[model samples]
Structures are given as structure tokens and as C-alpha cells.
Target: MRFVRYGAVGQEQPAVLDADGELRDLSGVVPDLAGGVLADLPRINPQSLPRVPGNPRIGPPVGRVGKLVCIGLNYSDHAAELGVDPPDDPVVFLKATSAIGGPNDPVIMPRGAQKVDWEVELGIVIGQRAKYVTEAQAPRQVAGYTIVNDVSERALQLERSGQWTKGKSCDSFAPMGPWLVTPDEVGDVHALDLSVDVNDARMQSGNTDRMVFTVPAIVSYLSELMTLHPGDVIATGTPPGVGMGHRPPRFLKEGDEMVLKISGLGEQRVTVRAEG
Candidate 1:
């Protein structure tokens, strides 16, 4: 089942996509797709839910995102592209929850920012609380997965940053979800393909198979460093082809558009806009 949330920004209602691809309202059944509600996903029958009257605006599938953890350079090619050695352990960082935005929303370029860039990452949504979880147990703690565009500002991140979070936590930076696909529905998480296109030109294309640290490994590694709670989102790093790694480098400007997709996780379309 593909879980979703639809409506205006703050008033999104829980919903699910039936096998026929029709939207079914889950608002009457679940309060929102977050925390314990994610754990109850298997118990709900999407087919039995009332059908949404027509196509509605889709919002970020999960709400009340507790923590947004990210892994840097998890892909071997991405590391190579940046002229950095792949880390033996995951390079972790935090993204402000305020950066969360609907998948197709406009991406705001910060004032005086010249290096705003894009990263297409696989987002892992935690279903249950976990601490010190073994790699074997990590998969069981996952609720599902979604696409994450890890939009960044290179000048803020690499040039003047105390921490990468400064470049990563801008409002509208993390555009997430078209649907939250359940773990069972996305068999073989590490074998999926992901790519990004800017203004119809393919900018990044790579497979999760190239990841230096696999999904389960990332989850387990993060568990040891911090307790992973329900509703916490972990962006498991991007494959090669980010703007920063391009020849002569390319950065986002007003009116630039980005389209990102991951197998089984749906797609996202984001248009760049100047911050007001």
C-alpha cells in the first residue's frame, strides 16, 4: 500500500493509494501518518477506506517528523566525485524539521546564496523506537521509505559552515514524499535505482547498489549513536551526480526545476524560487 497525506499544507489528511491507484481517505482511521500510527499500517485495509472525491494536493506523507538524520557520502561514487575517501563509518548530520516541505513544492534559494545544490536521497522512515539495534533487527524497525531531495547551499556547508547542518537546514530544503511505500512493498531496498533531473537535463543517476553503507547498516549505525524513535526520518545518502560534483560546478538559480525519483518510492518535482 502507498500511504499519503493530502490537503493544504497544515491541514493535510491521512490517505492511502489503493492498488488501482485511486486515493482513499484514511483520515477517519488514522489521525496522521506519524509515530505509533506508522506501526499500525499493516492493520489497515486501504481498499475499505472511503475514496477521496477527486485529486487533491498531496503533502508530506508523514507528519510531526521528530528528527531528520542524514548520512553524507554513503555512495562510493559520490565520495569519489568529491575527491574524498569513503568513510569507514557513516558521516551523520541533522536537518531541521522546519526544512520539511511537500515533494512538489517550490525550493527557496536563500538570499545571497550562490551555491544552492540538489541531492536525491533515499529516506528511511522509522516505525518503531530502536536503540542499539543490530543490523538483523534494523529492517524490522523500518516503517517504509520515501524520496528525499537533500537540497543544500555549498557556501554555507563547506565554505563558512561550523557544521553541515547550517547549509542543510534551510526552509524548503527537504522536499519529501509522493508516497510512503511500506517495507514489504519495496523488496530489496538496496537494489533500487535513483536519479535526478534539472530542467529536463539529467544531473544525477545512480543505483542504491553503489552505496558504501547499506540501508540496514545505516540504521544500525545510527541507533548506536542516538535512539531512533518512531516518526524520525533518516535520509540514507545520495548516489553520484550532485551539482557540487559537476565539472566547473552548477548551482540552483531562480526558475530552475528538479525532478527526483526512486524505484518504488515515487517521484518529486521542485521548482526553485527566490526566498521572499
Candidate 2:
């Protein structure tokens, strides 16, 4: 089932896509799509719910996000593109929850931002609390998967004195979710194809199979450091073709449009705009 949250910001209601691809209101059944509601997704029947009359605005599928964990350079090609050796372990980072935005929302370029870049990543949504779980146990704890555009400002990320969070945590940086697709519905998570395009030009194209550290591995690795809770999102990093890796470094500018897509999971379209 493809689960969603619809309506205006801060007032999004839980919903799901029915067999015919119409939105079905799930507010009567569950308060919202977060925490326990996500864990209990299998118990809900989307078709039994009333259909949403029209094309309501879709918001980020999950709410009250506890954490937005990220893996850096998880794809071998991405690491290679940056002229860095692939790490033996996952390169972890945290994207502030405030960065979360609707998949199709406008990406606000921070003031004086010089190198705003786009990364199309596979987001793993945790379903159950997991601490010290093995890779074998990771799948059971996964609620689903979604698309994440891990937007970054290269100058702040690499040239600044502190951590990557300074560049990664800007508002509207993480545009996520047209739908949260359950693991069962996604089948082999390792085989999905993902890509990114800027203004209709293909920028990045790679499959999850090229990931240096697989999904289960990333989940297990993160679980050892912190308890993975339901609704917590983990961006499993992007493949090659980020703006930073380009020879001339083609970063986002005002009016630039970005489209990101992952197989099984839906797509996200974001337009770039200067911060208001």
C-alpha cells in the first residue's frame, strides 16, 4: 500500500492510495501516519476508507520525525566521483528534522548560498524500535522506503570549521515522500533503480545494487549507535552525479527544477527558489 499524508502544512491528514490510485482518507482509522501508526500499517485496509474527493496537496507521509539519519558516500561510484576512497564503515550524519519538506515543495536556497547541491537518496523508514539488531533482523524493523533529496551547500559542508550539519540542516533541504511504500511492496530493496534530473537533464542515475553498504547493513550499523524508532528516517546516501562531482560544479540556482525517482517508491519534483 502507498501511504500518504495530505492537506496543508501542519494540518496534514493520514491517507492511503486505493486500488484505483485515488486517495483514501485514513484519518478516521488512524490519527496520523507516524510512530505506532506506521508500525501497524499492515492492519489497515485502504479500500475500506472513504475516498478523498479531489487532488489534495500531499505532505510528507510521516509526522513527528524523531531523527533524520544519513549515510554519506554509501555508493562506490559516488565516493569515486568525489575522489575519495570508499569507507570501510558507513559515513553517518544527521539532517535536522526541520529540513524535512513535502516532496514537491520549493527548495529555498539559503541567503548567500553558493553551492546548493542535490542528492537523490533512498530513505529507509524504521517501523519498530531497534537497538543492537543484526542485519538479519533489520528487514523486520523496516516500515518502508521513500525518496530523499539530501540537498546540501558544499561550501558550508566542506569549507566550514564544523560538521556537515551546518550545510545539510537548512530548511526545505530534505524533500521527501510522494508515498511511503512498505517493504513487502518494494520486494528486493537492494535492486531498485534511482536517479535525479535537473531541469529535465539527467544528473544522476544508478541502482541500489551499487551501494557499498546495503540497506540492512546501514540499519544494523545505525542501530548499534542509537535506537531506531518508528517514523525515524534514514537517507541511505546517493549514487554518483551530484553537482559537487562535476568538473565545473553545477549547483542549483533560482528557478531550477529537480526531479528525483526511485523504483517502487514514487518520485519527487522540487523547484528552486531563493529564501524569502
TM-score of model number 2: 0.98
lDDT per residue for candidate 1 within 49-152, as digits (tens), equals 89999778888988999999999999999999999999997999999999999999899988999999999999999999999999999999999999999999
In candidate 1, position 264 carries an lDDT of 89
Q: lDDT of each structure?
A: 0.92, 0.92
| Every model's TM-score | 0.98, 0.98
lDDT of 2 by residue, 1-276 (tens): 899999998899988888778998988888998989778785567778898987778899889999999999899999999999999989999999999999998999999999999999999999999999999998889999999999999999999899999999999999989999988889999999999999999999999999999988999999999999999999999999999999888999999999999998888989999987
Candidate 2: where are CA atoms >4 Å away?
Answer: 42-44
**Model 2 worst lDDT window (10 residues):** 38-47
Candidate 1 CA-lDDT value: 0.92
